[model samples]
Target: MSEAGKANKARSGGRSGGRAARRTLRTTRDFRMLPGLTRNIPYCEVMDEAHVERLDNASMNILENVGVHFRDPIALEDWKTAGAKVVGERVFLDRGLVRELIRTIPAEFTYHARNPANNVRLGGPHSIFVPMTGAPFLRDLDNVRRNPMLEDLATFHKLAHMLPALHSTAHHIVEPYDHPISQRHLRITYSSMMHSDKMFMGMTTSPKNAEDVMEMCAILFGEDYLEDHPVTTGNCNGNSPLVWDETMLGAMRAFCRRNQPVLCSPFVLGGANTPASVPAAVAQLNAEALSALAYTQVIRKGCPAIYGHYLSTVSMRSGAPMAGTPEIGLMNFMIGQMARHYGVPWRTSGSLGGAKTFDAQAGYESASTLSAVIHAGANYIWHAAGWNEAGMHCSIAKFVVDAVQCAMAHRLGEGPKWDDFDQALSAVPDVGPGGHYLGHPHTQENFQSAFFMPELFDNNSIEQWVADGEKEITERALNHARNLLSEYQQPMLDVARDEALRDYIARREREIPAASELNQSY
Candidate 1:
């Protein structure tokens, strides 16, 4: 055989053998936290000390001068007791007190899951990834995108359990149109409990929904255990232009008083809800985030809170909101810096795309934004995978592709390991000049982990590619998704605990009117 032919054979054969050895890695791979690069290496920093100070002051000014409106009378009263000046519904905070309250937040906290093995540690040095939370539609391999059915939601939870890339299956993976409105939370929580054992978000639609999820969680983990240890979180979204509506505040109150974490995030699209400028938008984001997070502490001190940022710009031509844009990347880094400055963990997003289908546009936009946020030091990443059409739809093909990327990103975040430097150095001398180190001891020892294995991406020579019929990555990913579903086994839950959950759901269902009744009542 020619020398080139021998090299190609060695490469292909060795990798194939590695795959066989690690076949079980896909099913049992339990790396939950995708770590960030070693702190010794500087990460991307957009703002210097002076810029950070300016931004901090800008946010504080908004809090002190403009203030935020709290529509809920109870929330307004709570803030008033915390020494904020309350003018009707709007509450203006004293910056000194706000600074003091923000300092009370812990640097790190543990979020226990239904299955103890899948519990997650937020803040500190770890970077955790979660799936897309709220998508109204679903797209499967047939390539038909439509409103999600009840079964689709359960399937997503199962997929999250099978794929180790996902640390948790987010609540409401996709809204189930088939279920009744009043009882959707019961089914959503039950679906997650049945299919996934990981930590998840709770319902924030209303205080009652939040209570229902907590009651179910208590059934799984004794009520006493859950009170001291947080198991689920609630996403408390702040209305743009400095407003805190009643429903979200009620949810936050429910989660906070119980010692569960709540992500205080603001949804801002520049040139619409917020100003066109990045600095202004970030300042506004901080102000809103601080207001809501401070409210959590007031409800109960030392409640776990994450500084969440979800900022995107509106397209000038069509007024459509864009994700994973250059402007978004720049603002994300700054927000991360601010989060760290306040000694709080940051909750950011990734795998966000504007493409309608799982294609090139999805690949580029999703990967770019996800990487940028990870490198910027986001702690809790939602919408980590399966997000398509600017968060309008979720795709299984995209989910599989992003799962592979999540593992790869974590490997990169660990930075270079030199634990075996002396051994590697000795092997270099064994292979003298003009000789390939294909058979060197160091190469043999490090080969398995030296490269990030592509789960769906095909890396082949042009000749080999041509012989394989040149399939698109999405088609390959679809095959992997199908295989995952076919082979997945539900993780075992204790029979009594499962029975308790079923009983809770059964009783709640009786209280909720049927779909026909729901339609008439509304």
Candidate 2:
């Protein structure tokens, strides 16, 4: 055999043997959290039969009582004919319609990322999806004030590129421009064309722009390619404290017709949007279900979708949504359980600690929130990192820190393996009452085998800390970020492809000189 063929055979054999060994080590273990601690509903104990019943009841109550308002006349009329009560702009959906809509949605679908590297398989028996960041900057890091503009499309792209946990990157923030709506759509187009190889989609405030962006993406990838690949997608945010409006619904429908996936995000703020209590939160979630599910069904039956629930506690004094609160963690857990009840895929935000610096508070909060989601078995997890100061600002430092936390979660999810277990047990046989296993062969084998996070907290002695000038977590993280950026090789866009992409961007820029100039200046 040729040398290359022999090498290939050896490599293939190694990989196959390794996988078989890992599989053999697997054991039945329940990684999910206890029922009450994880979700508002008794998901773990109730079994699939009872869970489905609860979901049905919840959907019924939402449709009959907490009707969603639709400003669009056509949509309102459609709902009215479908047994929904139309009170002027409001459409009260009944339980039957909700169930019908739920049935229309597909149980599983694939989300293609920028490249093959970004593509993710979503919706199965049990799976997990993680994203790097959430909505763009709501806070100003320098001034320490509410500054949404701090997060731009470019920043979003960069964050997406950096985040390993995030399966798909999102337009995390709003940008500043004269025509904010048009500019937002342009940004999505530019980012999708330039940054992602997989599925990339978002929604602007304007329905018209949303449709335009989707069209542009179709043109770029070709209509036939989009029908099959569906890389670019859109998000529909149901206004919390209320319901989805005409524009959002229209945008979602338009995209869905083109085979684009729509993420139905219901931003429910506890205490403000609903009641402060958990039950009230669940009730609000039911209302969200009615609205978001109806929109999905309205667009096209069985369209690719996600049950997105972003619930946070509101501070009475500040009127700001308190991220990383215990309430947020509980809500994420409950939402996952609810999604499981429906036998549909779920997506939820996480690791959003309302901290200004990359300190202990940031680490602890991120870890806690992420742990909840992992334990909940959420299929699609957003905001795995890159949130701080109540979802206001984007912290480069915190992003890296949260990434380490995400890695930790993935490791924990692996559970205990028997191969190592036997070795560990065998080595510990001689250890008794006062004896230690530190010197054992098993200890040596497993000690450093587990993933360990680099310390952001000061772990050195006083003398060493003082000598190192008492550097903070932010300093350490900043250094780490610099190293990563410096080491980052532009992922393989070959010469021909690179030239084609550049020319395309350049042509677009020339057509809109003013916007191009503005981007350059920024």
- Top candidate by TM-score: 1
After superposing candidate 2 on the true structure, give the runs of residues whose Cα lies further than 4 Å from its correct spot: 1-59, 80-83, 124-156, 173-181, 196-201, 219-221, 230-233, 424-426, 429-448, 455-469, 494-522
List the pairs of residues colliding in candidate 1: none
**Model 2 C-alpha lDDT versus the unseen true structure:** 0.61
lDDT values of the candidates? 0.82, 0.61
Model 1 has an lDDT value of 0.82
Superposed model 1: Cα runs more than 4 Å off = 1-41, 514-522
Task: Report, for all candidates in order, the number of backbone clashes.
Answer: 0, 20
Write candidate 2's Cα lDDT for 1-522 as tens digits. Answer: 999776555545455443444454436321221111112222222225564466557656766776676778767777766677889877777676776787777667666554665566666443443444344443222323343442344544554565454445555443433333334456555554565443455654556556666666655655687676656556677877457777777877777777777768777888887767875566567567557766677767767777877767888998987766777766666666667666677777767777776667877777778777777666666667677776656676676667667656655655554566666677655776545554454554455554353444565556779899887777776666665555443445446555654565456544543543333312
- Candidate 2: deviation at residue 335, Å? 1.9
